[model samples]
Target chain A: MSDPGKSSIPFISLITLFPALLLGTIFGIPHLIGEGSAEDLITLSGIGVTVTVTDLLFVIGLLLSASIMAVVYYVLVSKYKVAVLADSKTEELLKSRDFFLRLFDDSPVPYLMVAKDGEIVLPNKASQRLFQMTAEELMQYKFHELHDDAYFAQSRTIYDKFVRGVASSDVEFEVVRKDGVRRWVRLSALPYRKQGGKGKGGTISLLDITEQKAIDKVKTEFVSLASHQLRTPLSAMKWYGEMVLQGKEPLSEKQRRYVQKIYKGNQRMIELVDLLLSASRLEMGSFHIEITSFDPILIVKDIFEEVTKSIKDKRLHIIENYEGDHTNFFSDKKLVHMILQNLITNAVKYTNDDGTVRVSLTFSPDDLHVEVEDNGLGIPPEQQDKIFSKMFRADNARLKVADGNGLGLYIIKEAVESLGGEVGFTSELNRGTIFTVTIPNATEGSGTKSN
Target chain B: MVLQDTVLVIDDDNELRGVLQEALSDAGFEVLTAENGSVGLTVALESKPNLILLDLVMPVMDGWEFLERLHADAWGKGARVIILTNADDIDSLSRAIEGHGYEYLVKTDWKIDEVVDKIRGELGVQ
Candidate 1:
């Protein structure tokens, strides 16, 4: 705490010297003139007083001393200004430090400051509350050590990355609090460096996702329940319907027609249930992607064969234009099936009598490209934006078909996106619509087997 | 004259079991039926059926446990199974394929004739 104004001492001493010099010049000059006749030196009479050399020297020293005093005063005032500035700056720095500390302490999100070695340097109030421990107890453990044993390996990997100055976001972990309660947390970390300090640390933020994870688990369980419960009865109906159609008793024409209708209606009900299950799984993010090798053309052929009745009824022209020999491509079969099935079904259903529907498959090392084109009722421009929405049908489409659930395109979009692909379309009202799908090939070792 | 291959149809639903029994009988096999996995396993072990059409979800000792118990027996280790269930669960599908080297079919996705064809192909029967 040395004085900030201490540098003004030399200026003060110089100012004091001016008065002494004035006196010395006043008294010493007369002696130097020698006691004979002081009038011999240049003298001026002004204001009826004799102006001697000593008087002239004395006036000059007085003026010099006044200038010195003025210089000293300026230096002192400037020094005071500097001190005031330094004070405000220190106060501003302190206020900012307090603001951030308060934010870290009072924030709803749990935060922990970790040393470079992964030790818990500081745990805020929220983190202490989350772990159900005091700050002192938390400080005794490393950040990753607070996690459950089952997640310890994964947690260590993330912490290792963090210690290497790599930032990570939303890595999930399971942790047990001191009260023996399990919690799921998604943590994000960033490297932190202290101002004018040598050590580098990390600032980790945690979000308690236990409740959200529970909700997701429940949703997934519901999907599974719906799949089992709904499909079991549907299967029973289908088998019974098939048995009646294949019974040994001879049937009248009317009876045959009615049985066929029952069979067909049961089949449609099964499809709707399947569609609803797929949509639910897609929305719940509970669907798994299983990659396998298969002939995409065969898939196309199977779909075509399945819809042959409708194709025949409409007298639609079918064209298969496969560009490359990708008989055994690797990708998620379920997603591919969903994408192609929806597009081909829509094309078939919307196309009119004598209309043309073309299925094309182009394969490359990086992408599998599929296009289904139908020269039939194109989507109206007004409803094009909502084409991929769930249970949405175009006005023309609804008018053309009496029975349409409209979940096809929604499932297609969701499945395609999950597979890291894109589905797009081009259509003109009453002219045509072409739906295109481009999916990336699965990387090697991801697929389970070949068929 | 050759002996007709025997097939076991194990399912929880009674109507489904009856329908499958009739269909498989018509398809020229000695069909045996059980309403759940436990009874089906006992029948399979006793009769040594040529093939088993197993349903995943059942009342007593589900298909997974049945498979495990069957594989532990000497005569049941090589038993052929076609998983016939309406559930399209991927985890169970992969487990059945990779663990037991069995085939999986979503019942709703396949017609009875198609399922019969798969069974015939598995049995090498016309």
Candidate 2:
């Protein structure tokens, strides 16, 4: 491609004329040699015409100079047009660049461009406002500098990955401002390389999410409070039922049955409230972990005793299986109990009369495995994916039992997750469900206790 | 006359207190009732019941303050107190209760008979 701005048209035209001048001199020299003398009159003939050398030469020179000027004129005009087009293109590019720069500077979301080494390169106006510092002041700091020490270590890892040309999106981080106030932000970054893939850099954007976090906390607290408030009335009803049943005078059979129904209804309501409370506590991450060595067999036996009435009501055969040593087990006792209780309850509730429930405990050096298999109404295949979701109940399970609140499985999943464990289930339609849970033993260095 | 172990029931709910009183009296223990934590603390100091069924949330004084005040007295250090709460596993309270190895029960989860049995167990009334 020719650079119209760089090579001048006049210079090119002048060079073209030099070759023509040499040809003209060669033709004139031949005519002068054939004429009478070199200094005398010279005659030239060409193209079936005769003329004196001076007149011919003069006509040729005039024609050559005129055509050269025409060529030069055309070249100059085109070059002028090319130059004008190039100028406008450059101006448009510059305008758009300025517009985008302004947009980046004025955006409410904080924006930052960092170098390959995670050093802050260019911080936009919003970024400066977020940090309450000037771009110049922030330029010397790294991307993770604004985070607290614990978060700083984590942020450094993410920043290092970004510097290695990895992209990250919407990772939540808590950052401290210049005034020592902490706020939550979701940060995203995309890696960019220089032309020819030389140097690596990235653009980062942070969205302030402190308000959203606060609203979430408030919602969790409300759920907790509402559940507690519901429990008081339910408790009163339960005790009242107990008192009437335990009264001195024996009541009629119908009256006793009605009282029992009231008692059971209150009991169901109380269990629902408890599930809601547990779900909310799990959501809020407020539950504590107490690590103690206990026997899994003992826990299972105790749970069986707790549900002995239900077991007898259905005449369901209860089977216990202990695999391996079944001792030296350590985990969060409450969470383990919660997981097992929910599983066993579901097994008892959904199993048909005379159905069998197998409670299996497998112990290893590193983990404990619990399996509760019941010949009960299993979950529908299509809805199995949502079994562990909050407030999700299978179609068959819902039709079978009208009293379940659908939070038992969700609580189990959440509790197991918090204990750094895994839970899964296999079910066949109308046959049964076997829920299997594996919880890792709390090792010496790594316990499930998180405050 | 057979010697009966005295049990104090401290709660803000009148109906709950009455029912618990009846149930504990039927369970063969001398039952004392208080409407709130302050009253319960005074009754506990004066009567020195063998066991105390204390509710955590109440007007005038909560169960935590009552526990604190009760523990400040010399005789109260070894007093057996069973925390009965409608709320589920409050973080700080549960931690403190667990630290002290005190028995904690959710009121709704327990039946009257079960509570009586637990009180019997605590007082070694078998």
Candidate 3:
């Protein structure tokens, strides 16, 4: 077989020129060797002179036909090789493309390819279902378009942080669906990278967490209602028990002792119920706060006066260090009172007969700080974390007092947090405990403060 | 003090009321007992007892309603009504005392002697 590209032109030229050569020979040979006898020609040119013009032409024609056949064979072989290579390459490409496309389409989690500019470029079926939008509709929208204005801003900020490599974990945000219903979605994003490390765009995976939030809300409501219901009956029992113990009755010593036991038992039950209710409410986040602006100094004075009636023998030293007359801050008055009352009560209860409990109220421009320092059996370092937990009485406190339900500090912490405040304490066992409460100024509105 | 006047003990709990009646009878005053607020209000009006013990939670009419009726009725207006029940809270106790101007006592808290003393005190008996 001859090479088609190389042999075709040469073969055609040789075939055409061979014909002209044969014709030229046919016309010119007669003049050169004019009608002569074979013997006479043989004498002139020996045995070679016996050849004819027709035989020479036939030889030339046979050579031309072989050349043409070689050119056709080369063309057929080249075409077959090209067709085989093309078929194999196309098959390989189709298989790999189908595999990759199926993997992307069948992903369980909602996956979205978003441009760096926040536009939705490619969204899989799961993504479309998650956003409650059709594929064509999703392509026309952006990530921020899927949520309300406030949530959009928050989501954009989160995405920007993610793109900047500042966010380590997935972010949770509220997003609106096509039906305009809000939902919670957890998003994890990865930056799109090209071969040369250039940022092309990013991809985000979304997971819905709305059901968990609803369960949490319902639990909170249940705890709040139960607490209120329990308080009413407990209040009734406590009041009646007090009246019985204070009644004037001439009775035998045994009867008096029995009555005293019953009164004490009922008192303990009332305390346990109140603590349980508070703890449940705190756990459920059902406590309500009524924020009002009042002088912290005035609150301290009132709490001190109220606590003093219960602490007959204990000495309470209250120090007020406000720079101006209006040492006021916004807070729930009742909650603040309860917080101070709890701290002061604990101070007096833990202190010895004449031990000192000093309460300080300091005011700054941004915050109001209240400190209750008591020189009593201080809590151990190991038990500090458990002190604020419901029904968690420290071992040292248990030795000092046996009647506490271990809910005072827990309730105080919850109340403080509900009022957008912070509470902490420093203690050295056997030395003293200093509890510090820092509440923001009246300017901060009553909202849930996350730590 | 001889039995110069009768006391009406009105309470839902029969045993507790019986104990009060026995104790009050022993304390030199004749005592009458009623199971509910309506019966107690009736006895208070008919017997014209020197003192009345009222129960708060009752079947037909509650102590609140009985107190309202007693305040409006002609016969019960003068009777010294004291609340003797288990509903014992500052709010309820204060409402009973301040709202109705009646001394409130808890049944579980008060002993027989203490109840008698309260009755005698209200009766102006020495």
State the local distance difference test value for candidate 3.
0.69
Error of 2 at A334 (Å): 1.3
Q: lDDT by residue for model 3 over A173-199, one digit each (tens)? A: 777788888887777777666565545
Clashing pairs in 3: A244-B109
Residues B36-87, model 1: lDDT tens digits? 8899989999999999999988887788888888999999999888889876
Q: Write the per-residue lDDT of candidate 1 for residues A206-229, one digit (tens) a residue.
A: 889999989976876686577678
Residue-level error in angstroms, candidate 1, position A164: 12
Model 1, runs deviating above 4 Å = A1-42, A46-48, A52-58, A64-100, A113-122, A128-183, A189-203, A244-292, A297-451, B1-8, B21-32, B41-52, B64-81, B87-104, B117-126
Task: Provide the RMSD of all predictions against the true structure, rounded to 1 decimal.
Answer: 7.5, 6.4, 14.3
Candidate with maximal DockQ:
2
lDDT of each: 0.84, 0.84, 0.69
lDDT of 2 by residue, A1-451 (tens): 3456446766766765764576567656666677534454444445555565554665687578768878877878777888788888988999999999899889899999888877899899888888888999889888767776658766887787787677788888798877878888898877786554533878888888889989988998999999988887788788879889988879999999999998888887887888888888988888878788888788778889989999999999998989887667888888898899999999999999999999998888899999999998888899999999988999888887987888999999999999889999999988999999999988565454553
TM-score of each: 0.64, 0.73, 0.47
**Regions more than 4 Å wrong, model 2:** A1-7, A16-103, A164-169, A192-200, A246-248, A295-328, A340-417, A420-440, A446-450, B87-91, B94-100
Model 3, residue B64: what's the lDDT? 81
DockQ of 3: 0.05
At residue A289, give the lDDT of candidate 1: 77
Candidate scoring better on TM-score of 1 and 2: 2
Sort all candidates by DockQ, best to worst: 2, 1, 3
